[model samples]
Target: MVSPHSASDNDNENGPGVSLVEIEPGVAVVMGDRPLEALGLPAEFDCEVSPFQLMPPGDIQNLADKISLATGGLNLAAQGVHGVVSARGLVRLAPETMKAMKSGLQPLTSGGKNLGVLVGKGGKIAHQIRWVPATGAAATNVLAALGSAAVTLALQSQLASVSKKLDKNLKETQSIAHTIYGDRWYDLMGLYKNAMRAFREAQDLGVVNQHTFSLVAADLSNLEGKRGSFRDNLRRHVAALNTDQKQQLDYIRENSNQILADVQAVLVAEETWRCFHLLRTAHISCDTTMDPALKEKQLAHMVEQVKREYAQSMDEVSRITLELERMCSLIAILPGKRSISFFGSNNTRNDGEVARMAATLAKTVSEMRNRVHAIPEKPEPKVKALRRNVPDDVLVLLQYLLPEDEPLLALAEATCYGEVFSGSDVYLGITLTQFFVADKDKMSQEGIIDKMYPLADVRYVRFQEQGSPMLEMFTKTDNLSLLFNWWAASGPKLADVRRIRDLFATVMNIPEEEYRDDSLFAEAHQAFAAAKTGMKELPRKSRHSAG
Candidate 1:
């Protein structure tokens, strides 16, 4: 313990204004008008100080020595202060050291009213001085406020990130929905709905802004509507395509079966006839009981009969096969044949598969036709075959007109038109290189000569009926136009004329725009001009009733 000393022991008779009081064995509190300043704090350090109030407790000897140095060696007890002092205590602080200490204490002083500074042995500052509030409630409230602010900021950041992710997901879902179709579309739609649900939930949770939510909702609705419309349209298109494909497939299958059966029958008949002829020839050639010349004659007769029979059988087979090939070629040209496979694997096939089957059947038909043509035939006596008597040339011409890869498809006789030239009528026929006009009704005594025209030279073909039916053809190279007039009394029927026009359009590959009749345009224009002039149209009397 240290005793109070008189002021006379120091320089001033009046003691120093600041003093130190020992609060515990090693701790003392500084009390004075300016205790912080006496403790070596800078003048710039701002803190509340009261004369009676004690400063934070610190090492007793350190506090005494600091007060003595600040007051110029005045006794602390002479100023009415009492504290135990140690000889090894620190005295003064440099300006830089005081600044560092001020900075260290600034947080404590700014925090609360209650603050404490702890010191260890040799008068060194122990950890840091902590400013604690007088009450636990105030401290708890401060901490809670700080935590709330931090949490709010973090939540906002997370929400912003989530919003961005949701926006990207919505766009991706919409793009995928547009690309997929059929039942696959439904699956994608379900996923889109799920994404929308998540977005709505996020909006409810306040993670998405109201304005952004509204915009996204509108976009999603539009996307869904477009997807629904697309699905409906696609379904209708698929249904129509499936119907057409099924019809064509059925037709091909039925005709192919019929042709196959007919060819089989012809083949069987030919084979049986061939076997019988071979047996008969062998027996006649080997028979020793018969005369050699008689045997030779019999064998020759049998061979001739066999040849004739075989030729007839082959001709029948060739005809049936050609018809089958023609049907297959027609099937190949039909539209909407590609998408038929998805209907079901059980009864439906892709266009490639169907085309392959048609090609195979056509190949078989061609081989059979070749076999028919390969048989040797004896030359007949030369005679003038009239155009009316030999219609086979017309058939040959029709065959030649078709594409090499496609079989010849015959035109019905009703679809062929006859034109009367001079006093003779010649029916038109088609060939690969030219059109042949032959007199099917008239046979000349000298012979029949058919008129021909090159097809490639023909440029424009038009069928029109102004007063009577007419067919016109213009040649590009020759620059020649040929017009055929039809008299109602002897011309082709109306149906035949229509068919002839349509066939010509198909063969010429005429566009729909070119084939359309625009002759009425001039008359309509005249009527419009008359109407604009406010003129009354006059009705012409009918030819039959005018008399």
Candidate 2:
């Protein structure tokens, strides 16, 4: 109904050319067709002239009213003239409203003379309507506006469908992911779910330690750029990684492969991703057998990743340290050692009876200090301070170290007059403290461990009877050295009741029931058992019996 053409442009009967519909105020609709779309009209008010065309067409009457208003028509007849009906075809109306011109609105015949608008005309005498044309950029802008509106609705619907499908798939994937890979499956499975995710993390159910690897990686990038003074620090991080770190890294690789598959489907350089994959696989290939020089080079590169990973473990230890100590302390008071070990060494013996120790020694030029002591703290302060439950605990702790070579031996003997009783807590406390210092010394030496032989002549290397190696070593010496300014004199030790409760809890975790003290008696018993278990009787007695 609306076109750029004016009613009087052809009728210049007496005046200059004039616009049929002016651009000011709200657009006005007349028995003319030039103002349907105007210049500089705000985007908000366009094609939205009626919700019927923009939305679902349920209200015909409402559409008619909007059209009338859009064309500035006061009556209903002029409303229909200002609009074109698109439900069927683009039909121009006579100069009347759908309500008023309902009777005269007619169809066009195919006589080839264009009898469309004229068909409805010359019959009803109410009013006259004419087709109009718009020229210049105005027409283009209007069409674009309409197109944009239509596309918006279409895109909205399409997006809704996509969202529903994604949610369904996500749930199914997550459940299967958990069932399949435990904590790691979703992340790896996420890679294969593409319809690819833009980032691998989108599908991850795997634990992401809140460590900002970006910062650490950035540090590595800078460190590599220096390439001059990075060797020593690089070695420190490299030595930090153990077999456990490698296992975690392998799990991450599993997820990355899924990402690689997802990226290959659409990325331009599938080859580039593949090359990058090869590079990563090469990184994982590094092992103990690599050439020393090559190992060092890879270690430098690996430092970045290793640092990032180790920081996570340190964080984990910090989180559970309190809980772990509480649990371990509980077990310490239990009547028996809950866990067992069938290995080499015996855990418990008299202080002087520690006949052998499988300690390793490293001859190094103490980069940090001169003659690194077995125990970091001075024994003098501890000997002077008396503890409530663990009296002379410091002296007992010093006994784990050879103050000069046999100072701990003399101290142990002096404390008990050679009648060494088993009720002393001081020795246990000292043992853990000595372990802390020794571990620190080991680290400071860049993992150059010293195999100190206290009972160097002992029969076994590993402690037997303690079921769990972790617990066995832990009872003798915990990682208390890691704590800053740590000392037992500062507070009371764990209560006996709590200690017992915690021991039971640990047993539950290990699924073990009775406990073993790992005493000398037990070790001797195990040695005999092992000897008996491993020995075969001679054939003479057996042959006689058989005969």
Question: What is the TM-score of candidate 1?
Answer: 0.25
In the range 1-547, model 1's lDDT, one tens digit per residue, is 0112222323333223333222211122344333343443222212212221111123233444543443334333224243433222111222233344334533222122222333344555322222222134333443333222212222222222323433443353333233323454444444344444544444344333343234334344444444445334433322332433234345444434333333333333333334333433433433467996677567567666655655664554454445445434344434334332322333444544544443443344333322211211221212211222435534443332233333222222211232424434444544445554445442122122244555655567787666545565555333222223443213345445555556555555334545666779999999899896654333333444676
For TM-score, the strongest prediction is 1
| Model 1 weakest 10-residue run by lDDT | 47-56
Please report how far candidate 2 places residue 190 from its true position, in Å: 22
Q: Looking at model 2, which ten-residue stretch has the lowest summed lDDT? A: 358-367
Alpha carbon lDDT of each predicted model: 0.37, 0.26
In candidate 2, stretches whose alpha carbon ends up further than 4 angstroms from where it belongs are 1-245, 251-490, 493-547
> Which candidate should be chosen as best, given lDDT against the real structure?
1
* Model 1 stretches with alpha carbons more than 4 Å out: 1-253, 338-547
- Per-residue lDDT tens digits of candidate 2, residues 1-547? 2212124322322221111121111222122222333211122121112111212234223333333344333222222434432211011112222223234534231111111121112342222233212222332333233322222222222222223333443453333224433533343333333212211221131211223112122233332322222223222323332333223223222222222122211111211122122223223232335685665455345434433443343233222222222222222222333331111123222211111110100101110011221322324432211223332433333333322333221111111011122221222212211212223222222222122322212121221212211112222111111111122213332122223223322322211333456689989999998888656554666778999
